[model samples]
Target: MLQTSPRCSLYLVTPLLSAAAANAFGEIFAEALEAAPVACALVRFVSGSEAHAAAIVAPLLRPARSADCALLIENDVRAAARLGADGVHVAGAGEDLAEAIKRLKPDRIVGAGSLSTRDEAMTAGEMGADYVMFGEPRGGAQTTGLASLVSLTERVAWWAEVFETPCVAFAQTIEAAGTLADAGADFVALGDAVWAASSPAAAVRDAQSVITRAGVGVP
Candidate 1:
């Protein structure tokens, strides 16, 4: 199997909070990212550019030569490559993921998102998904919020046990992120929980502390 470098200190999912959440979200995310001292900072972090979100975020990030950035889309793997994102997250709900992988080749890190189904997990693994992102895909139909959480997380667990693809678990809040680490998630995805904070630096520290307290080793 192919190897992924490993997880970073802050894995941030972008475009958080509609208008209300957007006001300061970007600044907070950048602030938190910078505060996580580069001396001990393991990595630059991960961001999802579903639509043209990458264009908006890329400028804000202006990632260093060493920074790591991923663009997670509903299905467009090619767009990710075009944008020069470090990785691409493909959802199982889309068309055959293998085809997407073929289009992307060895450049983009391909990850498949799941909501916890055995078949879906196996299919992703068989398709050679570089990483398996288990956790409910957030910010879609609002009604599915609560249910998507457990379903996605459980599937992440299953994928880890059954597939070669490593898993990243998404948590709605910092506390929940810690829970995911406890559950053995390889990497924890933090959305607005930390990004929307008044002090993104403090938020990163809070989440990292919780992750450490939960006994999950950071890469």
Candidate 2:
């Protein structure tokens, strides 16, 4: 999270984008984006029928696109393509990075996550991934799980120093955002830390302020 490197932006992720939750969540997401600049927002659906998940994402497209925020669907290429999403976040190392790229290539984004080691991360970069994320919650990927703060900071700093592929450091708290910034993370990802706040928009503003204070410029 070095303040001296390329400017870092926020990468937002929804708690769960289910059909029953889209309308209410969309309102909060729109408010957050309006309050601060975001690199992208992932419409995450944990577990559900594909049809149901697709229906859930349908209502969220308008708000994110209108704000000019890239909206990515988590771990679902079919939904990303069919729903006209900006891209796809291929969670965990178990997923096929190459196939995902091929499926969505030359147009949509394909970010690789669930990286627990430098080799896996570098491999993703070599595979033509748009970005590689670390410290994100894992979905039972044996290769790697979320790393500790010390480990995450080191990983981000290492990647920022050596690689051009942008790295995202998942920040569970405002303080963690600053720490990641100092470590040279290319982006700070906010998940439960924002949505669980009493005011989601205010939370984003606060997160942005933290990143700025750390000497990391925001886009």
Which candidate comes out best when scored by TM-score?
A: 2
Error of 1 at 142 (Å): 8.4
**Model 1: per-residue Cα lDDT over 19-133, one tens digit each:** 3343355455456666542211111222442344454435434432233334344455655566565556666734757777887757656677653466666677677777665
Off by over 4 Å in 1: 1-10, 16-27, 37-54, 64-74, 93-96, 140-153, 216-219
Cα distance off (Å), candidate 1, residue 190: 1.1
Q: lDDT of each prediction vs. the true structure?
A: 0.55, 0.79
The local distance difference test score of model 1 is 0.55
* Pairs in clash, predicted candidate 1: 116-155
TM-score of every candidate relative to the true structure: 0.71, 0.90
> Hey, what RMSD does candidate 2 come out at?
3.9
* Lowest lDDT block of 10, candidate 2: 137-146
Deviation in angstroms for 100 in model 1? 2.0
